[model samples]
Target: MKAIVITSPGGPEVLQLQDVEDPSIRDDEVLIQVAATALNRADVGQRLGSYPPPKGASPYPGLECSGTILAVGSSVHRWKPGDQVCALLSGGGYAEKVAVPEGQVLPVPEGVSLRDAGALPEVVCTVWSTVFMMSRLSPGESFLIHGGSSGIGTFAIQIAKHLGVRVFVTAGNEEKLAACKNLGADVCINYKTEDFVARIKEETGGKGGSTLMMLSSQLASVWYDISVWCFDAGVDVILDNVGGPYLQRNLDSLNIGGRLFLIGFVGGAVTEVNLAPLLIKRLTVQAAGLRSRSPENKAEIVKEVEKHVWPAIAAGKVKPVIYKSLPLSEAAEGHRLMESSIHIGKILLIP
Candidate 1:
């Protein structure tokens, strides 16, 4: 099997395509002949040596993939060698074949191509878990997502809007904002030229709904400004991906009984957060990671996604936005595109 190996911690140049031993399946796992894999920020972090795979996981960087089952473990009952599936993987999706726990594999949605399904698992599960399940973004409520043109953001805007939530988003430019608006965002702010907080205030009448989603790296530098923004218009729920410097301000930004879902730490991990707001506002803070979750837990998320989200994709109400698709050997180029942050959606690697 040929896999994209991280030669060292650094830039895209360090990713090397090399022959590796085919993965052996555990009793409860399935071997997938990977058709495609998708690029994620986690892959970049892993390639740069900041993120490491969990114990007993693949050393390769891909987090999700689409493929056909090549073999099934003795204990696996729901899948067979001929099944067309897409799976949520902890790692090893950057190869020709990957062994995944049976529970993490899902039948590809009807009408969605096997190649495009590679981009679904990560973004769908991440958004569904954080925005809908954890944050409880109810219909008719105002919802704001940072990085509106991102994979997660693009998916989220569609899902939220489909559910009757008035969506707001911030992007780097007009084109990106227009893209988001076309996806049903009610308000789009060009973060480069406008103050998102002020825009939110103006749009929502100074009572920006209790729910917010932060998926940008820029949060680290503007945490204080956001805190001040929150002082004027309180927030309720925050689906925060960037931790570190944003922690304290996240606490400050919430209204009474606000819940914060911490999903990632692209920003530095170490930081000081004042506890006063937690006590005063009775805020609930919880952190979750999909990759390190138990197989049963992942299976539950997969089941929920299939039941609630898959139909949306099947119906053309929501769709995966693909930026580019390159051959598996050009994995480095995918990483380069991700690092450049020029892509508005998922970048795929076809095997």
Candidate 2:
């Protein structure tokens, strides 16, 4: 199998196309003839020699893919050869074939294109597992999603909206904000120009503000007002993908009894945290990784997507936000695009 390999830590140029051994199928795994794979921020980090794959995961960089089952393990009962599926991979999705646990695979929803299924698994799994399952985001609750133009952000906005949750998003530009609007983002804040905290308060007439809080410290000055605004408005829950240095602000932005769910530290990892706020406000702080979840837990996420997310796709109320598609040979370019942060959605590589 020909796949992209990161030869050393450096720029996109570090990624080289080479032939590698085909993955052997395990009794609990299925072999997929990959039709497509999608780029992720972690891929770039991996190429830069920063983030290493978890133990026993694929050394390849892709995190999600759409493909056909070529062979199923003897114990794989739910699917067989020739079934079209999208899967969440721990890694190694950038190849012609990758072995996946049967439980991580999902049938392409009705009316969804197989190639576009490349956009589904990672975003759906990440959002559903973090925002809905772990955070307990409910209907009518004010939900603020960062990176609104991102693949995960777009999916989060659509899924929350379909479930009757009030949705807010922060993007880098007006164009990205417009895209969020098309996907039913009630409030779209351009972090490049607008103050999301203040704008969120104004949009919800301060009601949503009181129930949602800011979660990034990279923009402490910018988010300081958010801290004040959300505190004044009384925030209930917050989803923090950028952690580390911002932990203090996340605490400051919360209302009494608010929940802060930390999923990633795209900003920086090390931080000094103060416990006084956590003690006084009775805040619940949680950190998790969906990729490390058990097969049963992953299957539950797949089931949730089937029940809650697929219907929206079938009804055309929400569509996967795809930015571009490149050939498998151009995997480095895919990583380059993701690193540039110019795109507002998923970037797929067709095999």
Candidate 3:
């Protein structure tokens, strides 16, 4: 099998396509002949030597792929050879073939193409796991997602809309903001030019549902943030990827009892945050990495996604946002596009 190898962890130039030994499947796993794979921010992090694969996981950098089953392990009964599927992977998507646990594999949605299915697993699982399953973002609620033009953001906008939630998004420029808007984002703010906190405040911040209900501090007299109460309690949930730099800002953007889900730290990861808003507003903060999750956990997420999200795609309520497709040997170019952050959505590597 030919896979993209990181000759040495550094720039995109370090990624070299080479013939590698074929993957050996476990009893509960299946071998897939890759059709396509998608690029993710984590791939760049791994190439820079900051994020290494979990112990015993694939050494390559792809997190998701769409492929045809070549062989299924003895323990895997649900899938068979020739079945077309997409899978949430810990790594190894950047190859002609890779091994995956059967439970982590998903049948391609009725309306999505085989190649586009490669972009769905990671973003859909990540969004569903964090924003819906964990955060409990319900219908009629207002949700805000940062990086609205990125792969996750674009999908988040559509799914949120499909679920009858008001969506707010932040992008770096007008073009990205426009793309987000067309995808059903209600409020689009350019983080590069405006203060998102202030924008969110202006858009949804209203008389915060009786301030007394949100007060939890003994020093309640000093807890009055007029700006917060002047508008509303902000949004019901926030999905953030900017990490450390936007930590405090994310808390401020949420309503009382609001939930914040973090999946990445594209900006620097370390930052000093004021803990006041968290306590005052009763915010829930959580961060997770798909690659680090146990296979069983990923399976659970994959199951929930197929059950809850597949219909949305099949119904044409949600769609894959693909920016570009490159050959497997051009994996380096895919990384360069992702790192440049110029692309509005998922970039695929065709094998």
Compared with the true structure, all predictions reach lDDT values of 0.83, 0.81, 0.90
TM-score (C-alpha) between model 1 and the true structure: 0.88
As a whole number from 0 to 100, the lDDT of residue 296 in candidate 1 is: 85
Q: Summarize candidate 2's per-residue lDDT along 1-351 as a digit string, tens digits.
A: 988888889999888889999999999899999998888877877888878887888898898899899999989999999999999988998888999999889898788899999888988888887777777888877777778888888888888888888777778878888999988988777776875556655664554334344445446456432332224543456676778865776665555676778878998889887666675567788888876677788888888877877888889877888999999888878877887888988999998
Candidate 3 regions exceeding 4 Å error are 207-232
List of clashing residue pairs for candidate 2: 210-233, 210-234, 210-235, 211-235, 211-236, 212-235
- For each candidate in turn, the TM-score is 0.88, 0.88, 0.93
Backbone clash count, each prediction separately: 2, 6, 4
Q: Which residue segments of model 2 deviate by more than 4 Å? A: 204-230, 272-280
Best by lDDT: 3
The alpha-carbon deviation from the true structure for residue 106 of candidate 3, after best TM-score superposition, in angstroms, is 0.5
In model 1, the Cα lDDT at residue 27 comes to 91
